[model samples]
Target: MSERVIAPKSRGFLFLDSHPTGCRRLVDEMWQAVPEPVPAGGEGPVALIIGSSAGYGLAATIAGLARVGIRGIGVCFEKAPARRTGTAGWYRTAATARLARQHGRDMVFLNGDAFSDTMKEQVAGLLAERFGGRLDFLIYSVAAPRRTDPDTGHVHASVLKPIGSPCTTKTLVFDDDGAPEVKEVTTPPAEGDDVEQTVAVMGGTDWERWITYLDDRSLLAEGFATVALSYIGSPLTAGIYRQGTIGAAKSHLEATARALDERLGKALGGRALTSVNAAAVTQSSTAIPGIARYVGLLRGVLGDAMVSPTGQLVELWDQLTGDGPLVLDEEGRIRLDTWELDPAVQDAVAERWSVATSDTVPELADLDWFGDEVRRLYGFSVPGVDYSAAVDTEVAWPTRIN
Candidate 1:
C-alpha cells in the first residue's frame, strides 16, 4: 500500500472518495462517546447487524460493542480502494473492527450484498459455529437503491416519489458559491410498478426471510430481539417521505415487524419491532429531495437538543438492555424521532420553512453546518484531521468473514 494525499471529491451531494484517517477518527470518536460498558455475564451478548458499514447501522454496531460489550457480526456492501479510494463505509467498518479488537471485543465483518441468500447463509453458519449458535439481537438498517431478489432473480429498484400527485417542496441545492440555496423541486408521482418495486427493495420481505432462516436453523437465542431502522419525517416532508413510495415500503416494514413479533413471541419469547430514528446527515439521507432543507431547519431550531445517530443508538441500547421495560408508542414501535416531531420543534421549523429563501437560508437554517456535516459523512471536513497530509488510501478489515 502506498500513502497519498486524497482530496475530497464530490458532485452535488455524492462523494467519490474517502479519507482513511478521517474515517478512523470519526469511528474512534463514536466509540469513545459510548458510555462505559457494564459487565457481561458468561460469554456476553452477540448481535448480527445488517448494513453495518455506515449511518445508523454503524452507530448501532458501535453501541453494541462499546456500550453493551457485545460481540457482533456485521454485513455491508462497500467498495474497496483500487483505482480510487474505497467508500467511506469501507474505511469506517475497518476502523470499527480495529477499535473492537483494541477493547478485546470480537467483531467480524462481511462485505457483500446482504439481500442475497448466500450472505444470509454465510452469516447463519458463522453464528452457529463461532457465536454459540445463538443471536441476542439483529439490527436491520440496509439502505440501497436497488436489490436483486435471490429467489426470483429479479432486480427491483426503489424510487423516492410520492404515491399520488406530484410533490413540490422547498429543497436545498448548492450554488456556484459552494453554499446551500433554497430551491423548489417537484417530484413526480410513482408510475408503473414503482411503488411495488420500492416496497420489494425497502420493505420487510427480506427482513422476514432473515428471521425465518435463522429460526429454522435454530440460531435465535431465547429472548432474542430484532429491530429494523425506519424514519417518518414531519408533515412538511411527508409528501416526499412518509406519504411517498418510501413510506409505502416502510409501512410494509412496520407490518412485518408486527407479524414477526407475534411469531417470535410465540416461539421463543423474542421480540421484533421498528425503531423510527431521528433524521441525521447520512450518505443515504443526503439524496432525499427535501431532507437537506428540513435538516438544516432542524439543526438550527433544535441545536444541541437534536441527537446524533450514535447518541440515538446509545439510548436504544440502554432501553433494550436495561432493567426498565422498553418504552413503546401506541403503534408498538420505538420512537426516537419524538424530539424531531415535538410540537414546539415542528412549529419553530415550519415558521422558518415558510420564510426561508436563498438569501435567508443561512440565517433561518444552519446551512453551513449542514454542508460540513454532509462532507463529514465521506470522511472529509472532520475536526482534528489534517486533510493536507498524505495518508494510506487502502485500509484492511481485521476479521472478514468469508
Candidate 2:
C-alpha cells in the first residue's frame, strides 16, 4: 500500500496542502504566454529574487528561467510540510524547482524570512561560493504584514489606513458559504507613529541592507541591476493605497532607488530602480480594504486589456535586458501600470464603482473570475485536478530551509 496526500484545511487566511497539479498548471500558463529569449550564459546569469514564491515574485522567477534563462536563488518564508497542513508556497516552490530543472536551469528556493539579516548573509555567502563571488541581478518583491528589525530588535506592523481623514468604502469578503459579500468599511486616518511603523515594515530599509552587504562584500558583479516592485492605483482606492501609510513606505522605496542608483553606479557600475507594477489578484492584495471589489470590476472592464503577472514580467525582462535603450519614466523608474491606468479602463472602473452595490455587483463585476484567481493563488480551483484524490502533505522541498 502507498501513502496518499490529502487536502489540508485553511486556518483563516492561511491554507495548507496545496494541489501540486494546480500549481504546475498555473506555472505552465505563465510561461505559455512568454516568448523565450536568447540564452544569456552557460549557467545563466547568477541572480537573486527576494520573496520569490507567489504573485509577482513567482511570475518573475518563472520568467527568469523560461524567458531570460537565469539561474536564480529565491528567498521567502513558508511553513514546511506538516502532519495536516503544508503551506501553498511549499508546494509552489517545489513545483518551481522541478520546472526549472526540466528547462535545464538552476534554481534554489530558500525558505526563510527575507527581512532577517541572517538570511541575507546566508544568501550572500552561498552566492560567493557558488557563483565565484558575483551576482548579475537582484529582485525585491516581498510583501509582509509585520517586520522585526534586526538591529533594534523592534517589531513593526503595517497598517492599511488612510493618512489624513476617515473614509468609507465598499470591500468584498467571502462568506462562510463561499459566497462573496460586499461590506461597507469606514477607515480612520493614520495617526501618531502609524506612518513610521508602516514604513519600517514595508519600506526600503531591508532592500538597502541587502545591497550594501552584498556590494560591500564584492558579491555583486559589475553592471549588475536591481529592481523592487511598487504599486500606485487609480483615484478610487488612492486614499487607502497610494496616499496611505503604505504609500509612505513606497515613497521611501523610490527614494532608496534614487540613492542606490547613484551609489550602485559609483560602487560597481551597477544600477538600481523601482518598477511600478499593475494591480492584480494576489494573496496580499485581497486583504487590502476596498481592493477586492475594485479589482473584480477592473477585470471585467479591462478584459483582454488586463495584463497578467507573467505578461508584465515578459515586458519587464525585455526592457531590462533588451538591445534597445533602457526605457524609463521621467522619475527614472519603469512604469508597468500604464495599461491598467489607461483612460478607457479607469473610466469603466470608475463608472462601475459609482453604482456598485451588493445586488448590482454580480452584474457589473466578474466576481467569479476574481474568486478563482484568489483560489488559484493557493493552488486550488485549477482545471483537471481531481479534488478527491489523496495528496501527500509531506512532500519534500528540494531546497534549503532555515
Candidate 3:
C-alpha cells in the first residue's frame, strides 16, 4: 500500500486532515467522554444512523455506543483514501468501528450516497441479516449540497435565501491567505420554485421515505423512535435562517415529524420526533450566509454554555432513553436548545447584533474561537499532531462493513 504524504498548510488552501494520530485522539476523547451507562430497560440496543460521519451524526453515534452500548449501523457519503487527499470522515468512521470492536460492540458502516434507494435497500437487508430485522432508533442528520430522487431520478438543489424580500447582512468569508474577510451581503428572496426545491432537498421527504420503506419491510422494532435534527436560530438570524428558504424546509421537516408520529404509532407502535438543536459551528452551518458572524458573536456572549455536538447528543440520549418522560414542546418535538434561545441570551445577542459591524465584530465576538472550531472540524487544530508529518492516506479502513 502507498503511504500518504503531508503538505504544509498554505494560506488560502483548505486543510483536510490532522494525520491519523490526531484523528484517533479526537475520536478517543469523544468515546471516553460518554457518560456511564444506566440500565437499558425497554430501549432496544440497535440503531441506524444516516449521515453518521461528521458533526451531530458522529456525536450521536459516539454517545449511543459509549453511553448506552447501542449497536450502530452508520451510513455516510464520503471520499475514500487515495494517493493525495483523504477525507477526515473516513478516519473518523474507521476509528469508530475499531473502537466499537475493541469494546465488543457491533458497529457496521456503509459508505455510499444516503439519498440512494439502493443504499437504503442495502442497509435494510443488512439489518435483517445481522439485527433480526428490527431497529430501535433511526437518526437522520444528512446535510448536502444537492439531491437526486431515487424513484423519479430528478435532481433538486437547495438555496439559502430569505423569503418574501431581499435581506442584507454581514457575511464572513475566508481569504486565499486564510484570513477572515467580511462583506455586506444582500440575498434576494426565493424566486420561482426556489422554496419548493429547497424543501425537497433539505426537508423530511427523504426521512419519511426511509421510514415508509423500513416499516414496509418490518425493519423497525415495536416502540421504535426516530429523530431528525433541526435548527431555529435566535432572533438575529430569523430573516436569513428561521424565516428563509432553509426555514421553509425545516417547517416541512417538522410537519413530517407530526405525520410520522401518527403513522409510526399506527403502523409499527413507534414514535417520530424532530429535535431542535442549538446553533453551533458545523460543516453545514458555516456555509450559510452571515452564520459565521452570528456564531462568533454568540460564542463571545454565551461563553462555555454554547453547547457542543457531543454535549448535545449526550443530553439527547438522556432524553430518548432515560427513565423520565421525554421533554417536548406542545408540537411534540424535543427542544434541546433551551439555552441557545434563552430570553436573557437572546436579549444579549440582540443588543450586540444591533451594534455589530465588520469593524466591531472582532471586539464584540469570539471570532478567533469560532475559526478554531471550524479548523478543528476539518482535523486541522488538534493538539500534539504534527502538521508537517507524512500521513499514510492509504491506511486501511474496515473491510467487514455490513
Best by TM-score: 1
Q: Report per-prediction Cα RMSD to one decimal.
A: 1.6, 2.4, 2.5
- lDDT for 235 in candidate 1 is 89
Candidate 1 structure lDDT = 0.90
TM-score of 3: 0.93
* Cα lDDT of model 1 by residue, 108-174, tens digit: 8999989999999999999988888999999999889999999889999999999989999988999
TM-score of each: 0.97, 0.94, 0.93
Model 2, 1-402: lDDT tens digits are 224655535553345556766776777777666775545336778889998988899888888888888886988888875554456777778888877776777777789889888898889888976667889999999899999999988999999899989868998877667666788999999999999999998899999999988988888998899999889888899888989999999999999999999998997888899999998998898778999999999988877678898888777777777633667899998999998898888998999999888788888889888877877887787887776886555667875432
lDDT of candidate 3 over 162-280, digit per residue (tens):
99999898877767665566788899999999999999999999999999888889888888999998899887788999899999999999999999999889877788999999988
Looking at model 2, the pairs that clash are: 5-390, 5-391, 5-392, 6-391
Clashing pairs in 1: none
What lDDT does each candidate get?
0.90, 0.83, 0.82
Model 3 spans > 4 angstroms off: 1-18, 37-44, 174-179
